[model samples]
Target: MTDAIKANIEKILQDSHVGPMATVQNDKPHSRYMTFFQENLKLYTATSKETHKTEEVEKNPFTHILLGYEGDGFGDEYVEYEGKVTISNSDELKKQLWIEDMKHYFDGPEDPNFIVLEIEPIQIRLMNKKGKAPKVLEL
Candidate 1:
């Protein structure tokens, strides 16, 4: 990735933390808005172990995520992220991904039902920027 592309991607990751994450189930796409925490290019999102997503990911570990589009139509930038998923319930990660808002869904970081989905990127693209075409980040 070029410096500009990398910078834009970092901006997006910093600016956009909430977006739809898609997983495959029964050969169909299942998507839901999730809050993500990223490190380098890896992304992680907390979810319930009992959720359909956890099961779907177990069957098919692939996922696609869309982040950084805040609905401003005119040349707004966004990211198209395609990756592999790993369901994690490690206390370390649960604690790391814990946030106050998640209390609505989880009791706490140690909540037995709480789990995280760790995404390992397979492909990523910076999309819909002013005049440039979609740019794929080499990884």
Candidate 2:
């Protein structure tokens, strides 16, 4: 990866704690804000298995993630990721990604309704600042 892209990627991962995840439901787009963590260069978000998002992903694995943050005198930088979602039941993954603060949402990593949204980015488009064309990278 180019240094600029790599730097932007790290800035995104460090600056933002949540992103909007978009999924398709009933042939329409649905989006929701979610807190995410990163592992192995992939983004992870956990949701209830019974939620609409879980059902949507089961039918269509494609998802889009938008993460952004305002920078110090650098305007805003945003990253868009196109990825395939995988329904994960891996206990180890949950354990690894678990945060104490997140327990309020999940009861625990072992909660029956809990499921992981593993987004493996296939393509990334990053806009470093206002009025600049995005830099696109294939993952």
Candidate 3:
């Protein structure tokens, strides 16, 4: 990614904590709010192993995520990610990324029902203001 694009991405990630993850299920679009953390140029989020989101992704790995920071006067600043989601139970990744609030979702790295949703972006589009469409930036 270019410095400009990378900066834009980091800005969006830092400004927004929640995003809607869009995935296709049975040929239809499904979306849900998800809290995410970005690391090593990949996106990570935790989910219960028994959720429908987990089952849906297992059938189809493709997904789109949009996160933003809204301003009262200025247009909403946001970034959209087009990526593939990989679900796994890697202890090292969990430990490395764990934050305090994650304890509510998982007992620990060893939580049986906890799993990480890793998103690898193929492309990213960012729009920081109005009168402009999202500009595609490489991942």
Candidate 4:
């Protein structure tokens, strides 16, 4: 059962690159859409060092992510990712997740202001697939 859920989650992560990432600020939930890159069960998204989300994560590591709906309608499967976020300036990772579109935000992956938020999921729930109850994966 766990294997099936893990595989389902993996496929969701791979197919769902864009999602809303929510963080806490002043005890209020702050959320914004972001393009995500995944490695195994981990997720990464790029942002500027000065972004509000960056500061929010430093103060509060907890985050919630929703990804993997194809927008075809009610049956589209998705995953809810609840995790801890870490800010990273490592060029190795920056290069790995970099894309030409990012040029508008920074000079390059080496830009000092370029940073990535690393999210490690504490719980993942497979959602909205065939009307079944949400299957959870707790790490």
Candidate 5:
């Protein structure tokens, strides 16, 4: 990828706070909005172990994520992520990614039901009207 594209990708990853996470359930696509956090290219999201989404992920590890689009206008930039997810129960990771707002769903970072969904992207496509072709990022 060119430096400009790389920079734009990083900016989107850093600036966007929410995204749609899609998972398959009963042969149908299920999607929902989620708050996202990233460590470099790796994506992380918090969830309760009791949720249906968590159960769906346990059955199928693959996921699709849509991020960066703010609905400002046509031609807005966005990223589509194809990845495999693994559930993390690590206390340290939970603590590291925890925020005050998370208390609403989780008792605290130590809440047993609290878990982190780690997404390792196999392919990421950076797309917008400016580019003639979508920038396929290296994993």
Candidate 6:
């Protein structure tokens, strides 16, 4: 990817917004809203081990995530991520990504059931109204 394109992608990733995450379950697609956190190109989300989403990821590591579109009706800019997810139970990482608001779902950063889904993007497409074609970003 060009430097300008890379910068744009990073901006979208850092916008502090939630996005739709799609995972496969029983050979069908299941999607839900999920809060996103990123480190460079890698994305992370918090979830409970008991949740069906976790189980789905465990069974099928491949996932699709849509980010950056916020329904403004003006901009069509967004990103589609194809990635492999790793379920993590590292205390240090959980603590680092933890926030006060997460207590609503997770007991705490150290909650045994609390886990992090780390998405390693294998392919990313940057899409927008400005471009006639979607730009594929190199992972």
| Clash count, predicted structure 1 | 0
lDDT of 6 by residue, 38-133 (tens): 988899999999999999998999999999987776556888889999999999999999999998988899899999999999998888756557
lDDT digits (tens) for residues 82-136 of candidate 4: 9999899898999999999999999999999999999988999999887889999
State model 4's lDDT: 0.93
CA deviation > 4 Å runs, candidate 3: 71-74
Measured by TM-score, how close is model 2 to the native structure?
A: 0.88
Task: Give per-model TM-scores.
Answer: 0.95, 0.88, 0.87, 0.96, 0.94, 0.94
lDDT of 6 at 103: 83
Tell me which of candidates 1 and 4 scores higher on TM-score: 4
List CA RMSD, all candidates. 1.1, 2.2, 2.0, 0.9, 1.3, 1.3
Instruction: Indicate which candidate wins on lDDT.
Output: 4
Error of model 5, residue 65, in angstroms = 0.7
lDDT of 5 by residue, 5-106 (tens): 767777898899799999999989999999989877789999999998899999999999988998877689998888899999999999999999998999
Which wins on TM-score, candidate 3 or candidate 5? 5
Lowest lDDT 10-mer window, candidate 3?
68-77
lDDT of 1 by residue, 15-129 (tens): 8999999988789999999999999989999988888999999999999999999888879999999999998879998888788999999889989999889999998899998
| Candidate 6 lDDT | 0.89
Per-residue accuracy of model 2 over 58-130 as CA lDDT, tens digit each: 9999998888755454657888878889989899988887778867778888988888889888887887667
What global local distance difference test value does model 1 have? 0.90
Q: Any residue pairs clashing in model 2, and if so which?
A: none
